[model samples]
Target: MAETDVISIDAAQQLATAALIANRTAPDIAARVASALVASEAAGQPGHGLSRVPSYSAQAQSGKVDGFARPSLERVTGSLVRVDGAFGFAYPALDLALDALPEMARGNGIAMAAVRRSHHFGQGGLHCERLADQGLVALVFGNAPKSIAPWGAKEPLFGTNPIAFAAPVPGSASLVIDLAVSRVAKGKIMAAEKAGRPIPEGWALDRDGNPTTDAAAAMEGTMLPIGDAKGAALAMMVEVMAAALVGSSFGFEASGLFSGEGDPPNLGQTIIAIDPGLSSGGTYGERIAALMTAMAGAEGARLPGSRRIGARLKAEREGMEVPRLILDEVRKLAGGQSLSRLD
Candidate 1:
């Protein structure tokens, strides 16, 4: 195994921020990206955490992502909001949507925001969790570069789309559910490839439709969906909600997110926030608590997000141990040394 280095949460954030700034990202934008990446790291999602900095910095420096672009918000209706990322990182666009959603949902009982021209938004659950923290329910849908094939086909057509839901529970952390349609996220395969490890069988197929343990081949091929045909159908649903409905590029139309040679991904994300108090007549808290109690009461049963919550708490209390190679790469980027490509 590769050597590892320990880093506190604050230090990790600072390092990531410096790396982005060195690669031409504005200070404010770099900070937002760093915060999201570090939070993902703390939550035990390494694929969406520090591992993304190299590619992100490369894209910013290459103009594939507009490092200095500012996102704009448009209130399409009383409860409908639209945000244009302007081909920038997705964090600022998502921030604007989250900031506007609470007031609109409370007033209208429910509200939705559609985001377009954005890049990857790490850990959709985090976005929904924010709304849940404010006593509102939230759902987030996002599309990525093509990676999964439609059922019964070798050619890839859909991304490993993700869906996340979060609901408030009185006197406790919110219930959060987040999952990628694929059997595993593409980032995991990328990580394995970077580590020179082979993936387990059934996770993906080679370009010729043969199952393979090679991580590099899997990246050039198709990711198996979570529930076979059922998962593919879910990915299609997300593609419509996040891309078609939002007027953004389809998964097949987007370029690789790991490389800096192509045009912007122009991805899309849709977030919906609902005011539980208005919908449930103020009984939401009690009802949710009862449901939580029943679920927790079951033998050998664990609540959703339990593992992630534990990981976050442990990271906060004891810092994180990051791979030494990844830390070195980040440090080099922070010093203004541009990499031609991360893939």
Candidate 2:
């Protein structure tokens, strides 16, 4: 096992923020990104946590991500909002959208936000959960750089798009469902490679389209989709909803996100918030509660976000155990040490 260091969440965020600022990210933007990364870590998603600092910093230094860029928003209709990320990190843009969306949904009973020219918006479930906390049902779709191929062909064409949904229950924690179209997120393979570990065979296929257990090989190849064709179909759906609809580059057109060598990914994200009171007429809470009760009664049925919630609570109380290597790298960045390579 890798040697790990336990760090308080606030301290981790401080380190991340300092590292980002040293790498040319604006202070405000750095803070937002740091907060999101830390939150993802607390939720047991290390792939999107501190591990991302090196690449993100490298991207900022390379100008692939405009560290100083600020997002702008527009209300196109009574229930439609459009945000331009201006080639910046996605956290600020998403925060801008969320700040306006809840009120819009409450007023119009349904509100949709389309974000363009954005970078990665980590852990989409968190976004939905925020809406659910506001007494709204929320859905989010995001498309990334191409990493998955259509079911029939070998050449990669679709991203491992993610879909997230969240809904509130009368007096309980919101239910959040988040899934990646790929059998597993490519980040996991990247993490394994960093740790010199082999990935599971079924997770990815080599360049020749044969399944492989080598993490390095998996990174160079295409990811397997969940439910075979069905997952691929879902990726397409996200592409249309997020990229096509929002005038962002298609997955095939975007650059790789893990490197600082190419152009900005120019990804897109679409968020929809619905006021359940409008449709359910006060019965939504009761219905959701009943469903929850039924699931709780099942022998071993675990709620979708239950584990994540538990992880968050534990992290809050005991801090996070971050890999020592990763922590050292972030510390170096925070200390203004430049990395020769982000990989």
Candidate 3:
């Protein structure tokens, strides 16, 4: 066994890919999903990282997720696309959106893609950053498994829906903003539960509608909204934009994220891409630079996603660590292969 958990990035992806393949995921799709999970790890978002593999593999093996599902896309218009994930993991569906977005944006000035029958969208920023890399501004919205309540209610009616936006920053990294509608993402709470830790107050209320510091209780209860009623309203808006408008299941109708007990989440996501020049002629970058410059000058002002981007840089050089237990579990899923052999 490796003495330290500090694993190379390649090893992480390879381990994840092998585990997905063992669970019956198609080779290509498994690789894509693995890479996305590894990318999540690189971005300092462990909640969406490799820790997801055991549940994902279990779901795939149990037939709760169609490991071989082929995502299909249809253009409803020059500027709009509809994608069906065929009940697969969401990364492949997102790959379809990312692949199609730039060309559609160039042709139509703006383009939108609606994805349904999907699974968890690991991280919004990565999806948006891809389009931004193509010199277009992008927005990504995803509805997750339900873990939040409507304002003034105890029912978990909405997912901790996340939204992300990105734009090229001229000669620098893209400006990206990704956020969950809840006060804190439910994944963080789940991670805490796995680590056997208590959650902070104000993060959630137990099923009886009372606050609890227990992580497991928080998972069984309602996640507090970020800005109270405002976040609830935003979550409702996402329920409409990503689910109702896309013909996908509402958060309340979806199964639990960590379980294979019910139907597939059959969730929805929306991605919008726009050519910067469409709205700004040729001065979009200049306008953005001015705003960024001003923001840089403002006291205590820091750009959103700065720390996330920084972590990516760090992960690239120093790689990252995967707990020995997680690595062992995934390796076992991958035919009980040794890490040395798997890598």
RMSD of each: 3.3, 3.3, 2.4
- Model 3: CA > 4 A from native: 1-4, 323-325, 337-343
List model 3 lDDT by residue over 49-125, tens digit each.
88789889989988889999999999899999999999999998888888988999999899999999999998899
lDDT per residue (tens digit) for residues 64-90 in model 2: 999999999999998999999999999
Q: Pick the candidate with the highest lDDT.
A: 1
Number of residue pairs clashing in candidate 3, backbone atoms closer than 3 angstroms, sequence gap of 3 or more or interchain: 0
Q: List the residue pairs that clash in candidate 1.
A: none
Cα lDDT of model 1 by residue, 74-129, tens digit: 99999999999999999999999999999999999999999999999999999999
Q: List the residue pairs that clash in candidate 3.
A: none
Model 1: how far residue 322 lies from native, Å: 1.6
Output the worst ten-in-a-row residue range by lDDT, candidate 3. 334-343
lDDT of each prediction vs. the true structure?
Answer: 0.92, 0.90, 0.87
Report lDDT (Cα) of residue 2, candidate 1. Answer: 60
Question: Clash number for every model?
Answer: 0, 0, 0
Model 2 TM-score, 2 decimals = 0.96
Model 1 stretches with alpha carbons more than 4 Å out:
336-343
